[model samples]
Target: MDIDARTLRTFREVTLTGSFTQAARRLGYSQSSVTAQMRALERQVGEPVFERLPNGVRLTHSGIVLRDYARQILTLVGEMETALRRPAANPPRLTVGIVPALAYGQQLARVTHIGRRLLSGVQLALRIMGTAEVHDAFKAGAIDGALVLTVVDADDPADLLGEQQYADRSDDLTEVRLQEVEFVPVTGVGRRPGGHGRQVVIADPDCPSQRWLPEFLRLRCDSPPEIHELGSMAGVRAATQSGLGCAMLPTALAADHEEAGGLRPLPGVPRMRWNASLILGRHDTRPAVDRQNLTETLRQATALGRAARPAVPAAEVLGGAGLGGEVLGGGATALDPDTSIAS
Candidate 1:
């Protein structure tokens, strides 16, 4: 039986979302269109694909088998489309979501240069956003891929993206571990002005590095820090520069400001380290192979960014507060694609 790509795509969306109305909302199609497409797909297969229920739908045994093949077929079709449509002169553009804090400094420049040299025809469009925003955007297909720091706790459901749905569907997403990042406590020039608990400035509290920070700090500091939340990394930098207490930031970010006296590392404060990974698509869906290829290029580009920056060892900044070789928690796990970088 010959099945159209659009019908297969609709089927995949329905399978992922579990509800016709929800799939329609995601695909910008009417519920009627979704039902019509599902009917057409079922007719093509000569069997019912979905066991419709009051709350949602479930796939039949035949539907499960079809979805496995459909994912592979769609991936191949996507590759074919790219090969056919890509311009000879201009490379296809890729949208990549990154932690907003990394947007500035030597990292951006180095990544851009590496992309130009290594990625050949592909252009990179980087978006700076918080972790939660990154997850949502990727799920909505707003970005082609992402490099993010996620806290992995085997017991915590939030640590694993779409864990429930991922287990229920055929596994096809690409995940690759890059490298670890060190987080350090930073202040302006000196101690807090009032001698009260240091005011803690954080750009995004939901950032994986920042998630356990308050409790982490309570272990390190005498009094609990007075927390101050800001909207952007720039704002956090500005506030910390004005002696707005202490903040935990990536060593790279703190390194950027150190030479100019914009920030001073708190020598005795604890450090947090987490692994960064390049993830394509959501937990439930596999990314197109072209996107996965671009993801590898992007990781190499960022690795170049790290190498280009002047190295600031974590030991130098953490001083006595360094955890040495210890990791905070068991870091994230990845099911890697066919890439050189190990998970």
Candidate 2:
């Protein structure tokens, strides 16, 4: 309706106050100016916008709809004004969506530390979300980059994590594989390390290992086993500690528990793999300095746990095929470590 910012401002103030005199006073305008603007607004809308009672005013149904649209229009106008007038004054801001695996661990801390060092005067915002949320942020242009963890095969990198799963990879995004965290199946101490009696505890839905673990476990059982869907790795670890189910975790995260006699390794089931990657938008408007620093931050952080872990080959894990072939009912099959770490 060709309304100007001033008129919209007047309309907004009047809606807030529900009184022409109050709105005019709040806006530093005469009541006649407020009335003139409202009359003009009604003419543009071809409907009465307000019912003027003796005490105050009330919005018509049309005015309510216009109020909704006016709020959106005003917001966009404010953003445009800000962008045009103070583009250079904006801080080197980075909005990142990170999986809980990295967000809750030292890896994320390392990233922020390095990010501050590399991109001085940087406004770094870290969002702890799932793979799906990370993808959504990227799609919405709400985030500049992301730290994500996904599952893959050790022997065949492209074998796909379970059939028809979008949890591991997004087709259109750029995923920079940072490091291969060692994956080991763990059960509570003295619990059946392999299938059958063991319930499987997995990271939240869309977690890197969430789908892959269930598929591997079902291979050992005739039907789908009992599954606990935890929303975070800490929950998964806590559940594992309680001897609720078997979980495949990065050795770095599970090593201490295994060593402390609270958890033990499960062997014979195929060793799963996880890919810890930094996902960035293909089209980035970030300053070159900010983008480079973010990439470095993710790279350094993903390496946090991989370096300290001791490597255990497939053969050493319960003879590489369970204590006996009892779990899988197959001959000695050694599953190797090929995973990415996260809390």
Candidate 3:
């Protein structure tokens, strides 16, 4: 019969309570509405769906059979409505650019896990690049976003901008500064200069340490050791652990090697401080297909603290609870929609 979902639900409710009045009350409908629905339901089936009693009512033989089919139809209708209401199961792919050092660090492992939960239905890809390559990737539109590591130094303000020349294009981009990451000089235990540890293990080209380490080493040691470039973090760690050379690595990675007694900090070498900032294409040119989802991803990713500069603008305040029961929760990002580079 041509019964609708609303009528079927009312019929099901009436059968559940065995009283039209009670069903109406529970369904938040007037008793007349329930009576009218039942009438239409019976009329469509050409038989009474309920047998009236002096007390309340009972289901007829046909009513009992109709009840089963009504429940199934209502369930199918509910499933259809939910499917139509939800956002697409897939959106445009989100390409993120990251430096080898950060990508290899412990924090990044956490970020990627949480970011995926935030960007729920979207495809995410990471492009491993050095500090300098990220700038070019963003300019060429090869990447949708990036996590850039900036050296935070007061005396050398240039470290803030460094190879990220996009600081000049304030209208084109915005950066949300994450927590500071510390880098330490580590070498295999008991190894010294002119040995396997003499050679410095570093990421190939464009790593900030590549420029600063040589001079730092020359001043600290009797004779500076040779530099050997390793492309991956695991390789660098393995090499350092086996006395291949001293590598400057994030404290988290370095601490792991130290705990095992396979590595130790180079004596008298100061730690380097860098800020992990998330870069986004700003304004109308923003590449994210689903702004709301991307905003939530940023919010969950930076749940640690508020931005030191301008705050997230003109969006719902979804606090950073870090992938709660609601994986596809919506929220705003800390990137100010209209940001100035000087800020």
Q: Give one clash count per candidate, in the order shown.
A: 0, 2, 0
Flag clash pairs in model 2: 181-339, 181-340
Against the correct fold, how does model 1 do in TM-score?
Answer: 0.55
> What are the TM-scores, per candidate, against the unseen true structure?
0.55, 0.58, 0.55
Q: With candidate 2 superimposed using the best TM-score fit, by how many Å does residue 261's alpha carbon deviate from the native?
A: 2.5
Q: Per-residue alpha-carbon lDDT of model 3 for 230-301, expressed as tens digits?
A: 877777888888877777777766776789898886653445545666667655353322443343344345
lDDT for every model?
0.62, 0.64, 0.61
lDDT of 2 by residue, 1-343 (tens): 7889779878977886679998786556999999999999999999998988898999999999998898678656654544554446667678888776555455567778766655556678898887667666777878888777654323232322222443345444555556666566777775542332347887656665565566555543435668887767778878888878878776677777778888777654544446666677656666543554466567666777663433333224322344323322123343333321110
User: Candidate 1, residues 42-127: lDDT per residue as tens digits?
Assistant: 89899998999999999999999999898678756755665566577766677888775555556667667655544444677888
**Highest TM-score among the candidates is held by which one?**
2
Those runs of model 3 whose alpha carbons end farther than 4 Å from true positions after fitting are 1-86, 153-161, 164-171, 193-197, 221-224, 287-343
lDDT of 1: 0.62
Question: How many residue pairs clash in model 1?
Answer: 0
Candidate 3, residue 78: the lDDT equals: 48
Candidate 1, residue 286: CA error in Å? 9.5
lDDT of 3 at 184: 68
